[model samples]
Each structure stands twice: as C-alpha cells, then as structure tokens.
Target chain A: MLDHLGEKLIARVSIGDFVVRFDLITIIMSWIVIAILVGLAFYLRRGLRQNIEEKPNRIQAVLDALIDVLQEQLLSNFISTSLARRMFPFISTLFLFVLVSNWLSVIPYLQSPTQNLNVTASLALLVFFTSHLLALRRKGGRRFLKGFIEPYPFMLPINLVSELAKPVSHGFRLFGNIFGGTLLITVVSAMIPLVLPVGLTIFFGLFIGLIQAFVFAVLAVAYINLAVES
Target chain B: MDLTLELGKVIRSINWTFIFTLLNFALLVYLMKRILFKPALAYIDRRREQIASRMEAARKSEATATALVAQREEELKATHEQARRTIDDATARAERIVSAATGDAKKEAERILAAARRRIAQERTQMEADLRRAYAEIAVLGAARVLDREIRIEDHQRLLDTLIDEIDEQALMVKR
Candidate 1:
C-alpha cells in the first residue's frame, strides 16, 4: 500500500463541519490524459482522407486498421450493426483514454489516472448509466426495470445485487491492477535501482496497460449487451 | 478488518477528481466523435461506395463493348454474304451473255454456208450452158465439109438452133 503516493490535496473547503478536499494530482493527470487523446484526435483528423489512391498511405492504413479491428469486434459481439455503430466512439475513446493513462505513469511524477479510484469509478459509472439508458430507450422504462425480476421471481434480489455490483467490479478491477502494478514497480525500482527493475517497469507498465485497457472496453461492451438483452 | 483500514488509508478517497475526470472524459469523447471517428469512418464508407460504383461502371462498359463487338460481327457477316451473292449473280449474268453470243454466232455461220452453196450451184449451171453452145458450132462445121458447098450450111445452122432450144427446155424441166 502506498500511503505517501495518495493523491495530493490541492485545496479544501469547510463549512459547518462539512469538508471537501480536491485531489489535484488525479485531476491534473486526468486532464493531461484528455489533452493527449484530444491532441491525437486532432492530428488524426488533419491527416484523414489525405490520399484517395487505391493504396492507402501510412496514416490512412493505421487508422483504417484500427477502425476495422474495432468494428469487426463489435460486429462479432453486438446483435446489430446499428448498435455497434452507436457504441463505437465511446468504447474506442474509453480504450484510448485508459491505455494512455496507464502508460503515462512510466514518466516520473505522472501517475496513471486510472490508478485512482475516482477516475475508474467515473468511467464505470458512465458505462453503467449508458447501458441502462440505452436499454430504457430500446425497451421502455417498465420493461427495462422488469429485466431484474426475470427467469424466476426468487432470483430478483440476487439480480438486483448483481446489477449494482457491476460498476463496482468494473471500476475496482482496473484501479487495483494499475495502482498495485505501479506501486510494485516503483518500490522495486527504488530498492534495486538496476536495469532489471527498469525493464520490468516497462513490461508491466506498457503491456499490462494495454491488456487492462482492452479488458475495460470489452467489459463495458459486455455489460451493455447484458443490459439491452430482450 | 485491520487490512481494510490500512487499504483505505492508502487508497485516495473520491473527491473533485470524479467530477473533473467525468468532465474530461466527456469532452474527450465528444472531441473524438467529431474529429476522429466520424470523419475516419465516413471516409472509409465513401471509399467503399466509390469502389463499388466504379466497379459497376466498369462492368457496364465491358458489357457494352461486348455487345458492340457482337453487332459488328453480325454486320460483317451480312456484308460478306451480300458480296458473295453479288459475285454469284454477276458470274451467272456473264455466263448467260456468253451463251447468247455463241448461239447467234452459230446461226450467222450457217446462213453464210447456205448462201455460198447456192452461188456455187448457179455457177455450174452457167458453165454447162456455155459448153453446150460450143458443141453445136463444131457439129455445123462437119456438115459443111461433107456437102462441099456454102448453100446447105445456113439450113444446117437453123436445125441446130431448134435442137439447142429443145435441149434448154429439157434441162429446165429436170431442174424443176
């Protein structure tokens, strides 16, 4: 456990025994990740459709491959193409944001935003809300709520608890891995101070980062699929 | 339970970070949808449509070319047939013309042969008449020698004239 690495408080306000502490590190890191993603987006937009030739240029090919892979995955998993199209941007951005945040910790003093419970919880909450919203839109409010009581009336409470636990598990899984991994790497590097720990950090930081990001997106998609099932 | 408290001590509790992270992620999603995903996906779709239409156009042109080739071949066949017919007709007409001329030439040769035969027959009759007259003159000269006088010669000539007239009459009857 890294008590010292706890998010630094940027400001605090207290009124009549109620207190609010703003975690500056997590907030700034989240903004940095957002900035990085948005900058990449702009760069991609600038270079988009630059070549109309039959053979795609380097940038076009990379973007095409990325979209193709994501779309193909969605097509395979989703019930319909329209549903996949509707959910594509959210899932893709989720992956890119988490992936970048997780990897950004490789630089000193730049902790992964996803390592913080606050950020992961927000993302999970987004998935949770979006899933229910879309289900409601598709099935109407009455039927959407009735889904938790299906299969057997006796299973209602268990289904409700399961639905509630989804976001918690989704958030904690990513948060725990990134936070534990970064802490372990930092401790090992401080103790050993050698090439082995450095290489290990790179491996855990980048490779695990990628895996965790993919997991988060896939889980989101699965949750959405589960929520919208008729 | 003690471990839980220690974990809580290490893990940073939620704060304004949640709100800021949410806002940042939302902004990022909107920006990505606008700048990156939409345009990129649109370009890909447009490229796909373009390729499909180009393929369709190419197929149509190819079909048209094939049809034109078939039509040209049909026209060529007709022209060849027409030319062959014209040649056949011209050959038949030439043959007819040659045969007609040959028939007329044969008739003209027969006419010339008949006219030559008739002229030869008339010439022979004239030569025969002349020979008969010469023979009568010779007979009158022999009679004068026998009588040893000019007085009986005139009478002999008159008899010869009557005999020659009778012979000419007989030759005319034979000819008829």
Candidate 2:
C-alpha cells in the first residue's frame, strides 16, 4: 500500500562528500505559495484607507472577511477583542500557510511540504518557540519557568514532559494525516485504476486536506493563547 | 538478535539527520515569520479597520437619520403652531365681522325707528291742523244760524274770536 505512493521525490544535489537528495520542487512550490501570500498581504495593506468613502476592491473585501472571521473566532474563544486584535494576525497567518501547504498534497504530482519531516518539524519548532516566547513576554522569565512546577514540586517532571510533547505531537499529527491520506489515495488508485479510486482519492484527499489544515491552525492558536494566558 | 542490533544502529545513524531536519524546519519557520507573518498581520489590521469604519459609517448615518427626524418633528410642530395661530386669527376675524354686522344691524334698526317716529310726528301735526280747520268752519255756520239773518262783518269777527279761543283750549287739552 505504501509502495504505491512511489519513492519520495528526491533531488541529488551533491556538495563535495555530502550527497543530499532534497525535494527541490516541493521547496520551490512552497516558496511560490509564500510569495503569493506575502503579495496578497502587501496588496491588502496598501489598499486600506483611513477614509471610508472609497469602496474596498474585491481583494480587499476578501481579506477583510478573512480577518473578520479570524477576529470573531479568537474573540469568542480565548481572548479579549483587544488581545485578539494583537495576536490574531500571527495565528491567522500560521493557519493559512499550514492550510495551503496541507492542501498542496491533493494536487496531482505535487508533494505536501508538511509530509516532509523536516518541514513539519521546523513548523512545530517555530510553534514551540512562539509559545515560549509569548509566555516569557506576558509572564516574565521567572513566572514562565515557574509554570513547570505548578501544584507541587513533584509534578515538575510531568509538566516538562507535557511541554516537550507539544511540538512533537503538533508536527507528528500533521505529518501523519497528510502522509496517511496520500498513501491511502495512492493505494486505491493503484488497485482499482478507475472510477472507484477517483471517488476515494477526492474524498480522502480533499477532506483530510481541509481537516488537517483546520486542526493545525486551531491547535496553533490554542497553544499560543494558552502560553500567553498561563 | 542481529536484526534488533541493526535497527538500533540505523536509529542512531538517523538521529543526526533528524536533528538536521529539525534545524532546517526551524530556519524555514523563522524565515516565513519574517517574510509572511508581518505582512499577514498588516493585512488583518487593515481588514479590522475596514470593519470598524463600516460600523462607524452606519452609526453616523443612524445619527443623521435621528437628527433629520427630530428636525422634521420640530418643523411639523412649528407648522402646527402656525396653523393654529392662523385658525385663531381667522376665528377672531370672523367674530369681528359678526359683531360688526350685529352692531350695524342694531344701528340700522335704531335709525329706522327714529325715522319712523319723525314721520309719525309729522302726520300727527298735519292731522291736528286739519281738525282745527274743520272746527272753525262749524263755528262759523252755527253763529250764522243764531243770528237768523245775514251775518254782518262785526258779529262775524266776534264769533270768530270766541270760536278760535275755544278751539285753542280744546286742542291744548287734547295735547296735554
């Protein structure tokens, strides 16, 4: 079943004795998506006006709707409107990037960056760093460290383990979902090679793609909120 | 036993790569934060501003509508007051006209009564004059009869004098 997905798309780019088979296409595609996202952001920022008489263009309206949804979600869930306003951008951006990357797997002949251990692990690490960074920023270093020893001194090891488990879980969850979905689609396509596999491919591929993206974004926002509050 | 040892060796060998991948992901996230996060935040802020602006515009429009309603009410009230004043003025004018007409009617009636009284007085005076003349004629005829002959100038004059005195006294009594 796993063999049906074929070998990983690896590029043999050698640097002297070290031979690294990096997935160049995946990285390039990710860069492209990131560039487009950045461009959209700049465009929206540029179009914003202090005076409301000028109607928002289509792109600006879409961006506004996205932000509004994010703001409402954050405000309702974990934070005050003011704090949500401050923190929503980071959370929303992380979600959008992860969502786009996860969906990338569904595209024929393209690899999901998240399925790559390096990509998922790196994103997880960033989330890990951000959680700590927010904690330190909000509570100060001493108080942030003190969170590990809550309830009793004996619980410190458990707290530490839990803290360490966050990034590992975060990365693994996304990687496993995309990898599993892709593997399933590949197997079905190989076995049936007809109308039946097409339905399964689309269902598992798109549904899992969307769900994984949502999970990643939601978890990220929740983690950030937790860190900031605790 | 050999397979387990090989697996352990493979795990140990892969650990460095795992570490390297972790580092690479960290670097990528860092770069993404710089390149993407800041702009995305700006976009979100822009979006927020837009929503707030729309809310403000709606509020302002509502305020304007309220002010317009109030102004309209004030104008309507003023118009109502002006209408009331006009009605009152019209009523006062009607009252004045009615009173003036009544006064004119009364004055006209009095003038007519006065004129009628003057006409009656004139007719009474004429009647009295006629009665005097008739009485004089009778007195002349009776005197003639008493004499049993033609009345001469001197007797006639005496009779005339006595008759005139009697007639004057009767007329004065009738008048009294």
Candidate 3:
C-alpha cells in the first residue's frame, strides 16, 4: 500500500521550468468534493416543501441547521444580514474547497493542493486582491490609501509592512499546517508499519483541515468587512 | 566574488514571471466568481427567501389560530350569559306563581269561615225560639190546675187557638 501511495505521488506534469503536477488520486478526490457539494445543493433546493402540512425531511433539517448557524455567525460578527447573505456563498465555497483539499491528504494515495506553497499563495493573493478591490470600490482609492496615515503619519511604513505581511502569513499558515501533517503521518507510518498511524493521520488531518479552513474563511470575511467599512 | 551580482541579475529577470502569476491568479478568481460563486449565491439567496417566507406564513397562521380561539371563547361566554338569564327568568316566574296561589288559598279560607259563622248564628236564634215556646206552655198548664173549674172543652180549645194564632203572626213579623 505504501509503495502504491509513493508511486501515485511520483506522477507529475511539468511546464518548462515550472512543474504543474496532475495526480490521478488528487483529481479523483477533488471530483468527489465537487460531487458532494453539488449533491447537497440539489437536495436542499429540491427536497424542501412549502406546504404547511408537510414536515421538513432529513436533508432539509440538516440544511436548515447549517443555514441557521451561518446566519447567526453573520449577524453577530458581521453585524449585517445583507452583507452576510451576499458574502456567504463565496466564503463558504472557499472554506469547503480548502477543507476538502486538506482532508484529501489523509487518504493513502492522495495529496492536498493546500500543502503546496504555490497553491496556498495563490489563494491568499486572491483574498488580498479581493479585499483591496472591494475597499477601493466602496471607499474610493484616496480613502483606502488614507487608512495608513491614521493616528500618525510616521506609522505609514509600519502599516505598509503589516499589509504586505498579510498574504505571506496567510499562505504560509495553511501550507505549514498541511505540509507538517503530511510529513508527520509519513514518518509515523514508516516507523510503525501498522494501521495505527492511519487513524491518527485521519484524526489530526481532519482537525487541522477544519480549523485552517475556518480561520481562512473568517479572516477573509473580516478583511472584506473592514475594507468596505474603514 | 561576482556571485552576489549574478544573483541580483537572476532576481531581476524573475520579476516578469511573478507578475504573470499574479495576473493568472486574478483571472482564476474572476472565472471562479462567474462560474461558481454567482450561481451558488443566487441559489442561496433563493433558499433564504424561501425560508423567510415560510417563517412569515407560520407566524400569520399562528395569529389566525389565536383569533379563532378568542372568538370561540367569546361565543361560549355569550351562550353562558344567555343560559343564566333564562334561569333567572324561570325562577322569577315560579316565584310569582307560588305567591298568587298562596293569596287565592287565603281568600278561599276566609270565605268558608264567614259562611260557617252565619250558619251558627241562625241555629242559635232557632234554639232561643223553641225554649220560649216551651216556657209558655208550662205556664198555661199551671193556670188551669189552680182554677180547679170544669170549663167547657170548646171554650178551652178556642183560647188555645187564639194564643197559637197570635204566636204565628208574631213569628211571621220576625221572619220578615
């Protein structure tokens, strides 16, 4: 099994000096994630009945609970249901994609894109651009630039450094977590040569995956809100 | 000695690739926004509206049920009041009937007592007359004995007849 997993990882697609690897396992796992999301959407949309006599089915109940939690989070934290509603889909999609990608690494032969610095960096860059773009669009370029000069003009360099650090730290955070988990699982399996490492790997991988995804999505929402408001 | 300069040249050459990656990431974000994010948001918005409308409908139905319950309570109260009024009227009517019966009974008792008193008075008057007659007869007998004379039977008969006729005419005047 280990040998097969190694062979699966070894496969790659290279582009000149840059290598854009495509693995059968990763592709297949990504498809599974997409299918699950699409199925959930369809079930939520089609299964809910409007009649008073009809009771909510299992899928509807699950969907309702999920929406309720999201709504509460948006209302309490974001302070605006309209903005939460507007932003929920994009944020949820990002969370699910990153989470699924991270969790894929726990499988025997699959790898997570989030473990790659390039991929994580790309995602972080997206957030960064989105925040600035929304800020500029809402507050205009002058106001957005004026945010750095607040409290004292001498702090502008510090503010600029902080802004530059945002994407780098965000990307590195995801990459480190996923990559470290993969390395630890690999080392443990090599030492144990048993199924114990698999369980530990799945557990830790899922925990880290969910946490990272939540952090990323929450930070994105906070950044967008802050950009638009201030 | 020239390694640092060579590194600097390489770094300068790599700036274009970095710019290209940034542009590529921007394009991907745009594509994702169009293909995945917008439709998903639309679907979510529709679902939210559906849920909100359902909640509103449930609230309206609850209000309607409350109103119906209040109406039923009011109707029951009115029915109870009507029953109470009917019972009160029936009780008043029963009391009036009982009072009228008692009054009639009292009047009937008084009428019977008056008739009995009148009858008793008439009997007493008759008894007095009989006693007076008896006394008169005894006196006549005594007079005849004391005289000790043999008077004719026809003369005695005529005297008795005269006395009887006088008594009869007196009785007739008293009756009138």
Candidate 4:
C-alpha cells in the first residue's frame, strides 16, 4: 500500500532489548542482487574464449569492454598489474551489488538495500578490513603501523582519525544519497502518485545509482592502493 | 506523518543485515573469481602468447622459403656452367677429329701419285728396248741379201760375218 512507502516492509527477528536484530527485507534484497550477479557471471563465463574473435557478439563485446575498463582502473591505482588482478573480483562484486541494489528502487514495492545503513556499513567494513589486512600482509605489521607516525609523530592521532573516518564516510556517502533520493521520491509520489514522480524516480534513482556504484569502487581501489604502497 | 517517521527509523537502523551483506559480498567475490575473472584474464594472456607464436612460425617459414630459393638458384647456376663446359669439350673433340681425317686423306693421295709415276717410267723403258732390238734384226737381213751374187760359200760366209760384226759395233755405240 501507499501507506507503507519509504518503509522497509519485511519481518524482523529481534533478540534482547538493544541487542542483535535481523532485517529480513535487507537480506532478501541483497540475495536478489547477488543472484542476478551470479547468473550474469555464469553467462559471461560460458561465453569466454582464449582466442577472442575480431568481431564478437554483442554480449561478448560489452563484457570484454567492462573487464578492460575495470582492469585499467585497478592497474592505474595499484603499483603492479598482478595486484590489480588479485583485487579485481572483490571490487567488481562490490560495484555490481551496490549498483543493482540502488536501482532496485525502480520497482514500486521494492526498496534499495543500499538505502539501509546496515548494508552500506557492511560493504564499507569489507573494504576497510581488506585494505588494512592486505597492507599488513604486504608491508608487515611493523611497517603498516609505522605509517601513521610518518612526517611527524604529532600527526599520529590525526592520521588515526583519518584512517578510521574512511569506512564511515564511505558507508554514509552511498547510504545518504540513496536514502535521501528514496525519501524525496516517496514524498513526491505521496503528493502526485502519477507520471511526474515516476520519471523523477527513474532519473534520480537509476542514474544516481550508477554514479554511486562507480564512486564506491573507485574509493575502494584508492584505499587499497594507499594500503599496499610501501 | 507518523508512517514517514517510522520509515525513517527503519532506514537508519543497523542490525544483523550488516553481517548478512558482508557474507553475501564475500561469497559473490569468491564465485566471480572462480567463474569469470580468473578465466577471462587467463584467456587474454593465452591469446597474447598464441599470437606471438604464430608470428614466430610465420617468420621461420619465410626464412626457410628464402633459403630454398637461394639453394635452387645456386644449383641452376652450376648446372648452366656444367652444360657450357660439356658443349665446349665436345666442340674441341670434333675439331680434332676433322683435322686428323684431313691429314690422313692428303697423305694417301700423295702415296698413290708416287706409285703411278714409277709404273709409267718402267713401262716406257721396256718399250724403247723392244723397238731397238727389232730395228737391228731388219738391218742385218738386208745386208745379207745384197752380198749373195757370185761368191763361194766360205767367202760369202766370211763377208756376212764381217757385216754382222760392224752392225754390232754401231749398235753398241748408239747404246752408249
């Protein structure tokens, strides 16, 4: 119903007061996006060839171009092509998941999972852990910890705050944009409930969805580069 | 207004969804690495190597063809030179045979001419000798007939003997 608009309308499993709670709607939306990406991956996998044709099918060409751009982006940021290849899967998965989740709002009854703080926080946390862990692995714990004291030891707290701020900003950025857009569309639809709101929803939700996905992947790669640099 | 406030609360909430989303993203990355990303990069690398090997094979074949052409050309040149030498040797042999045959013919002709001249000289000398003997016999017969008139047999015989001896002397002088 229109009454339930802008609300994540699904079941919840709550434990003790202020303890752990599970948002079933977020879980379902995430699963749907994951299923789509998996299906697409399988299709692309079936079509892959060692000797790519000069004139490939439409699907092949598009997928190849997507792979090329992603690799180029990674290679540009990272020091080595091997490192780029190693991080490609995680970055691509993050991009596709966010993009799909943000755009799912085009359906009248569906809410984008990225509109939820929990979902965005989880994604940002993954990037956070991955960057630090990889840095620690490559530079060793001593060197990685020592990076905070560089230029001057007085900058240590500032560097630590900045490092901690990465995930918070990364998560909030996507969540705010998507959630704000959804709220605006919900208000418009509540007023008009007609053609104008539909167009506005598509424009803000779909187009901005694509931009947010790209920005998130770019930030993730930049963070990885910062971490990996010795 | 109350519904909008509740929706806003739901949007802001952080719960077990975080854990689920992280698990989902991690699973997706794993599956994609196995099914798509790794294989695609491998395919591209394989394509590069294949193109390089093909170019190398083409270059090798081209070099082999060039070498074969050069070898054939050398063989052809040698064959032409050998043929020319054979023709020159045959020509020299023909010339020598012709010259030797001409010399043998000339010597045979000279020997035949010399044998004919000797035979002609011998026949002429024999004919002259025969004619001189016939003439002497006729002269002796005529002298004997003239002295046959009146004389006894012994005187007539002595005169005949003296005429014959004079004729023999004159013949000897002519022969000398």
Candidate 5:
C-alpha cells in the first residue's frame, strides 16, 4: 500500500504459538538473486571446463578478474595464504551474494532484500558466528575464551558488550543505508515523481549498492582476520 | 498486522522472516559453494598452476639454450686455438726444412769448387810433363843432324846428357 511504503509483504504460517512469517517478496527476491548467481557460476564453470585457454573470452575474463581481485583483497587482509584460500568460497559468496542482493534494486518496482533489517541482520549474525568459529578453531577453546577477559578481569563486561555490538552495528549499517535509500527514493518519487527519481534509483541501486556490499564483505573479512590472527 | 519501518518499538519489525532469511542464506552459501566459488576458484588455481609450469619450462629451456651457446662458443674457441697451434707448428717445420736444404746446397757447392781446383792443377802438371818429353825428342834429332857422323854408344850418351842438362836449367829459369 502507498500508505506503508516501507512495509514488508508478509505471508504467515502459524503452528500454535510458533508463528513463522515469510516475507514473500524478500524470499522471492532472494531466490532471484540466487538463480542469477547460479547461472553465472555455471557460465564460469563452462569456460573453465573447456581446455582452459591461455586467453579467456570477455565474460570469463571479467569473472576471473573479479575472483582474482577478491583473492587479492583476502590475501591482503589475512596473514596466511592458506587461510585466505580456505575461506575463499565463503567470503567470495558473501561478497557476491550481498552485491547481487543490493544491485537487484535497479529493476523497476523490485525491492532489494538487503533493504530488510531481517536479511541484513541474518547476514551479519552469520558473519559474527563464522568469525567466532574461526577464532575458536585458530586460538583453541582456551585462548578464544580468554579473549573475553583480555588485559584485565574487570574489562570482560565491556569487552562482551563491545563484541555483541559488532553484529548490531554491522547489521544496522547495511540496513540503514539500503532502507534509508529505499525510503528516500520512495518519498522523493511520491513528491516529485519526475526524471530525478531514476537518477536517485541508479545512484542508490548501483553506486551505493556496490559500495555497501564491498564494505560489508570487507568488514566480514576484517572480523575473520581479527579472529584468525595470533 | 501493524508493521512500520520506524525506529520506535522496532521489536515488532523483527519477525519469523529472520528464520527464513537465515535458512535461505545457509542454503545459498551451500549451493554457491558447490556451483560457483569452488569450481571457479579451483579452475583459476589450476590455470595459475599451468601458467607457472609453462613459465618454468620456458625458463629451463632458456637456461639450457644459454648453456649450449656457451659450450659451442668454447668449442669454437678451442678449435681456433688448435688451428693456430697447427699453423704455428707447420711454419716451424717448413722453416726447419728450408734451413737444412740451404745448408746442404752450400756444402755441395763448396765441395764442387774444391774438386775443380784439384783437377785443374793435375791437368797443368800433365801438360808440362808432355812438353818436356817432346823437347827431349827434338834435341836428340837435332844433335844427330848436327854431328853428321856415326857415333859410338858412349859418345851418344854423353851428348844426350849434355843436351838434357842444358834443357833442365833453361826450364827452371822459365818457371821462376
């Protein structure tokens, strides 16, 4: 409805007290992103599966370049090549998934899933959990637990709060930018309803989307780097 | 049913969609790992390996080529040195032969000169002896004609002696 432009299109499935609401639009949009990524992946695979050419065609070269750039970013952050390579699949997926989700807004009347707090929150939480897991694996149970206490015993509460705040800030950062963009675009379109909305949409959808997605991935990698380092 | 994108009482905006989103992301991560990241990165890595090996092969071949060139150059230099030595040896041998031949020719010429002088001296002595014999015969004939008489053995001997002595003295004077 025009009255609640920012509202999620919800579909509810209830089982007594446990109510599971699926944001239908968001799920659909997420699936669309997923399919696109899958198709692109296969296109990449097809190129690779062929007798790997010394010279790649245009599309494959772009894909290869993107992957290589991500690798260079990962290598720069992580101290070890092995760790970077090991986390390549997950980190690259995080970047591509976020990038695609954010960019989906360029289509008319299509909402970016990243605009939803739920989606960004989930992604941030996922990153938080993954970083902690890597910390535990790298530092072991003893060292990982010791990180909470830190330089002094009294600092544990502050450290704990700060640690908890990481995901909160991380999630809200993306959510704020995208949701704010969506709201601004919606409000501006309603008032002006001129050619200006198109520019704003492209600016928000392409530029901001790319930047925010990159920031998110970099933050995620940074978090992982912090956890994995000695 | 009262959902607003407001900061006020934002608790309601957090809903079961979080669960769905979580599941979707997890599924996507798995699917993407299988379909996208793993294969693409694996291929990229493989291609990197191929490039590295090819470059290594090229580098090895270049090293081998360089070594071969150095070896050939050394061989060529050695051949040149050997040729120079051979030329030097041949020049030495030729000089030795020429010098020996020259010495032999000089000795032979000197020997021929000495033999010719000895032969000339012997011929001169023989010619003088022949002249002396002819002179004695001429004297005997002259004495017979001058005497114009038959003479005994003792007187003829005496006359020949006198003529021979006179001829000897005259021949000595002519030689001085």
Candidate 6:
C-alpha cells in the first residue's frame, strides 16, 4: 500500500468506437471544486451594483480586497493597469481555482486535483498557448514566427528547445509539490490511522498548498506578460 | 519499492494527447470568468475612478478656499492702512487749525491793547488842558476881588502864564 501510494483509481467509459479512462478521484474532486466555485460566484453576483459602499459585509469585503490585491500585484509586475484589468478575470480565476484545489486536500478522504499531471499540464498549457497566441495576434505572423530565430540563425534550435520545455516545467512543478505532499501524507496516515499527527498535515496542506498556488498564479501572469511584451 | 518501477509508473501517468482536461479547464475558465471575476473587478475599477474624481474635486475646493482667504486678508490689510492714513491726516489738520487760531487771537489782543493805550494818552492830554483852563479862571477871579474892580486882559494873560508855569513844575498827572 505504501509503494502504491501514488496510484490513481480510474474509471473507464466507452463512446462509439472509443473508450476514455479518467482518474476517478480527480474527476470527482474536480467537480466538487467547480461546484463550490460556482456557488460562490453566484453569491458574488448578488447585489453587485447595489450601494454596499465603504463598509461591505465580510465575504464581500474579502472578495473585494482579494481582487484589488491581485490586480495591484499584476500592475506592480510592470503591466499597464488596463492590461492588468483585462487579464484580471483569467489570472484571478486561475489563482482562485488553484488555491481552492490545493486547499481541498485538507478535508478527510479528499485529494487536490493538482496531484494529477493532466490537470497541471492543462493549466500550464493554458497560459503557454494564451501567451503565444496573444503574441502572434499582437505582433503579427511574421514577427511572432521570427521570434524562434531570434538574435541569430544558430539560436533557433535552442529557442525551440527552450520553448518546448516551458509547459513541461510549468506543469511538473505543481504536480511534484502537491504529489509529494500527498505521498508523505499518505505514508504518515497509513502508519497511523486518519493521519493523526495533524502537524504534518497542516504544514503540507495549508502552508505548501498556499505557496504553490500563489507561485502558480504569479508565474502564469509573468509568462503572459513576457509573451505580450516580447 | 524500486525507484525504477515507480519512475516508469510516473512517466506513464501522462495522457499527453488527451482533450478531456483541456476542454474541462476551458469550461472552468469560461464559467469562472463569466461568473466570479467579471463583476468583482469591474466594481473595483469603478470604485477607483470615483475615488480619484472625488479627490480631485476636494483639491479644487481647497484651492478655491485658500485663494478666498488670501484675498480677504489683502482687503483687510488695505483697510487698516487707509484708516491709519486718515487718522494721521486728521491729526495734522487739527494741529494746523489750533496753531492758526492761536496766532489770530494773539494779533487781535495786541491790536486791542494798542487802541486802549492810545485812548489813555488822548484822555490824559485833554484833562491837562482842562485843568490849566480851570486854574487860569480861578486866578483871574482872585485878581478881580483883590483889585475891587473889573480885571484887565493884560493882567489876566500874565497871571495865566505864571500859573501854567507853576503847574508844569509839579510834574504829576491826575488819576480818575
């Protein structure tokens, strides 16, 4: 059981001539995270334009402060305010989703979706492709294409290798952190029923989870910033 | 547990070409974007704009107030300076009037005193003349009585002269 700590429980479904396999825990937990986010979003949507001015309720205040802080972080990272506002929806959503997903594992009998490489890759590739597409659209086809052969003809292959490595590193970084935490947690829990120590759970689930989520969101914004600027 | 076997499993865990996660995440982003972030960020942006405009208004009002205060101070200072000038002018005019009045009064007093001195001199001359005439008459009467006859003009004349000369020797003027 300790050796098989990282194994996923998969579910298989067939459609026409094809079959699809999904990690059951990740899928189930992904929906739960989505549901929670969606419900909170509905709560946020209520009374948006009303006079809740100066002094807002607790949840509204937190959301307000969170959005403001995130926007400032992007602006401070050297992006224009307009550009930051435009990117706010996507960047902040990523942060919220990742943060919730990372923290979800703190609950008993649950796991963070970030434990899966597939989801991490999806998120990293989202930023990766978004940045490149923005660059292509903004800089035009010729300039964007010429970016690979930048500085010299000899640098093209190196640039391509470096470009290919972005998604891999971006995805793997989160996966490694969350998965390692999960494994340690599992081994410790198996040693003692229900992960009794509690201290280790707090360290991995709360502390590392928050840091990784923050790092992921910031890196996503930075990558997008570089792409648009470059 | 062999690290090699575990490495193989981890490497095989990737389903690189699959679209399930890609679509799901795309949905999540779309929903999350549509639901949560859109309105919240918009509210924040609107609030910032309101704050900036309100501050600008406050600054303009403050500047206007300061300017008004300075203008009032300038007017007050001018009034004070004018009042002082008026008071100084009034004091100079009063002193000039007092000095002119004193000079006029002194001149009038001197003229009255000179007139009084001249009147006294004229009265003294008239009384001396009258006294001599009275003395001449008395002497003529006395000569008439002594002679027991009517007095002659030549005798009268000599008597009068002698009496006048005697009166001159006294050298005293009569008081009223």
Clashing pairs in 4: none
Q: Tell me which residue pairs clash in candidate 1.
A: none
The full ranking of all candidates by TM-score, starting with the best, is 5, 6, 1, 4, 3, 2
Task: Give the residue spans of candidate 4 off by over 4 A.
Answer: A1-10, A14-20, A49-59, B1-8, B59-176
RMSD of each: 10.6, 9.0, 9.8, 13.1, 9.1, 8.2
| Each candidate's fnat | 0.56, 0.09, 0.03, 0.62, 0.47, 0.30
Over A22-127, each residue of candidate 6 has an lDDT whose tens digit, in order, gives 6666777878888888888888766464663555666777677766677666445636666676767777778878888999998988889888888888889888
**Clash pairs detected, candidate 6:** none
Q: Which stretches of candidate 1 lie over 4 Å from their true place?
A: A1-19, A49-57, A74-76, B1-8, B70-176
**lDDT at A225 for candidate 2?**
77
Models 1 onward score TM values of 0.69, 0.63, 0.64, 0.66, 0.76, 0.76
After superposing candidate 3, which stretches have Cα over 4 Å from the reference?
A: A1-76, A189-192, B1-87, B121-176
Global Cα lDDT for candidate 5: 0.82
What would the DockQ be for model 2? 0.07
Each model's lDDT comes to 0.81, 0.68, 0.66, 0.79, 0.82, 0.77
Question: B20-116 in candidate 5: lDDT tens per residue?
Answer: 8888888878887888778787787888899999999999999999999999999999999999999999999999999999889988988898888
Q: How well is candidate 5 docked (DockQ)?
A: 0.21
Candidate 1: tens digits of C-alpha lDDT, residues A78-117: 7777888888899889988999999999887788888888
After aligning candidate 2 to the native by TM-score, how far in Å is the CA of A1 from where it should be?
8.3
Q: Between prediction 2 and prediction 5, which has the larger TM-score?
A: 5
lDDT of 2 by residue, A1-230 (tens): 54424344444545666655445555666665566566666666654543445667775577567766766654356555665655555566666677777766666776676666656666777778887897898899899888888878899999988888989999888878777777677777777888977677667667777777777777777777787786
Candidate 2 overall Cα lDDT vs. reference? 0.68
Ranking by DockQ: 4, 1, 5, 6, 2, 3
Candidate 5: which stretches are off by over 4 Å?
A: A53-59, B1-11, B95-176
lDDT of 4 by residue, B1-176 (tens): 01111233565566667888888888988987888888877877776787788889999999999999999999999999999999999998988888888888888887887788887777657645764675567565655565555667887787668767766876675555
- Per lDDT, what order, best first? 5, 1, 4, 6, 2, 3
